[model samples]
Target: MSRFIAFFALVGLIGFALPRSAASQDWQLTDANTFAPANYLILTIPQDEPQALAALADTLAADFGVSLAAEWSLNALEVHCFVFDARNVSDVDGLITAMETDARIRTVQRLRSFSLTEMFHSDPLLPLQWALQSMRVLPIHASSLGEGVRVGIVDSAIDNHHPDLADQMVDLFDFVAADPVPLAEAHGTAVAGIIGAAATNEGIVGVAPSADMVGLRACWQQDGAPGVCNSFSLARAINFAILNDIDVLNLSIGGPEDPLLTELINVALEAGIVVVAASGEGQELVYPASLDGVIAAGQVAGRSVPAPMVDVLTTAPGSAHRYVSGSSIATAHVSGVVALMLSQDPTLTSAAISERLNGSISDVETLPMLNACTAILGPSEACAL
Candidate 1:
């Protein structure tokens, strides 16, 4: 594994005292920017030949009139990644095609973004998260707080110091920058807040409050900045999750399909980790979720899509709470419930988890709404012999 990959592990950490980052989603700054990169592309070569990888990067840089920004090698998987300088909108597609024609290149992908909201919460808030009722998670919490289940979150920065997440976070690693210091936590804070915020009776509770969490940051952050994650960073995070024996992987971001990421998702599934993904708008699903062996979750109150999408309240970066509305939040709900099920039966495989979820689906119309009590309280389930 690369030194970058090696940085991720469960360890005792210091205090988080960074300034808070406020989120504002204006028209131009949609959440989709998190997964997609307009000017960047991720090139994966099958082998880890340093010279060959350097030559490829130089060739792409020279041909595209760009610079070689950085490179990383996944030694375990023998996958090499090269990140080139940004390009104009007119040049991105052509540059990607030019790189794809190389026989040495196994896959070339234009990094795209996925949508996930980060709203500041204030004023009169619901005493309890309204979405929990629809998800059917409240009842199951009586028996399972998702102990012993490790839920892995691959997204933007999370506030490791936030009271809601400080103690619950089992591990933290970054794929974008090797910063020895902790980076700003926004989207990641919100995502983790939903999945496993501590139930301290301070603010809105998380879905699997007691479940252990390992957060792998593939996206960077800035105040009012959209979520940012490229294929290379995301794959690196996924590889880390797989190597660390993560029980359930939560991918709350998705965009255009990339073969390299697809292969990694397949690898995680084959390793018996339950993978959860978010659904984008329209029938054409997003990557990973669109791929086989991933559970696609959409936020809907009923079978039919409502005019204004349902709003969900979850945890935020600071000690405060927030409301996020989208499929990403919905995906977190499913992941939390899945963790609850895993808490009851830690040996459940991806197939067994899916089977239980599928069998417990009370209504096909409400796609993302899950029957948590049934999924977790049912007979212990595992991969068939």
Candidate 2:
């Protein structure tokens, strides 16, 4: 575990107040340049060989024109992963192929980008929140407030000062900026509001108002554009969640399948952390959600491919709220339900929670609705009543 200690030391303080190494600052600026998939490639080398790793990085720089942008030691996977900023887009495919044949390299992958599963809509009647009625959230709240459960909201920066989330946020970390005081963004604030915003008379209430929420800003939003994240940033946040003893992780983002991200997610699952993610837009489930031992959730009203749909009303940045719809928003509600169950029992596995939710789905709604009351308090408390 000494290597794990070294890993954390390299990551800086506990709340991910990372002191960026020279290499890290380079990619931060590169990723900052545009939200489009970063021109970076991910590869891994053996652990405990700093000299060998540096030499390999130099060899790649000399042999292929790519330079190390950032590196993190994945203790659980027993490999040190590196993200290289390719000078040319053409160099990426060739570099990955060339690296695969090297004895020093354990694995190599092209970086994949991901985005939040939410779309914002303006509707005056959204304050009524029909989705709450569909889920029977009020009755479900009678049995559980998700008291004391720690849920990691792995998305954009949440507005910690938003009235709904002010008292609920336990911690905040910005992997995008490597700063503790991350700027509030719409997507993350909305997800936090849905999962565990403080219940108040003035604003909309969350599904599990009493759960402890940790705002982890892995995805970044620029100029009101949708929030986006790449494999390097996602892996860091997931690894932080796994090592920090976070009880539940809410990932409302999706992308193509990634090996490094998958390894980190599997580690979290094996450690008894329940991971909930948004289901895919098409017929298949996306990465992270697509992985085994993860709970895949989609909108109760169905996805928004062929039709424009209204989803849930939740918190937004700066003392506001909005109606957001998508498998992304749906994942938040499901995560809140999991918090409710965990708050009561504290031992439910992802599989058990999934089974409970599936068994309790209501047939009354044209589209299947999660019977939150029955899911939390058992079949006798079915929402059909």
Off by over 4 Å in 2: 1-127, 179-182, 299-309
Model 2 alpha-carbon miss at residue 287, Å: 1.2
In terms of lDDT, the best-performing candidate is: 2
Q: What lDDT tens digits, residue by residue, belong to model 2 across residues 278-358? A: 885667777777787888887423321111124578888888888888778888888888899899988788778878877
Candidate 1: which stretches are off by over 4 Å? 1-126, 299-309, 363-368, 378-385
User: Cα deviation of 317 in candidate 1 (Å)?
Assistant: 2.1
lDDT of 1 by residue, 1-385 (tens): 1111112222111211211121221111112223226676767666534455567677767767777554555445556555565654477777778778877678877654332211112213324576655555655665678888999999887888877788999889889887647765667888888898776545566788899999899987777686878999998999998899898899878788888889889999999888988776555567777777888776333321111125667666667676677777767877887888888877788778777776655543543345666676652211100
Poorest 10 consecutive residues by lDDT, candidate 2: 1-10
User: All models: lDDT?
Assistant: 0.68, 0.73
Using TM-score as the measure, the top candidate is 2
TM-score for all models, in order of appearance: 0.61, 0.64
* Candidate 1, lDDT over the whole model: 0.68
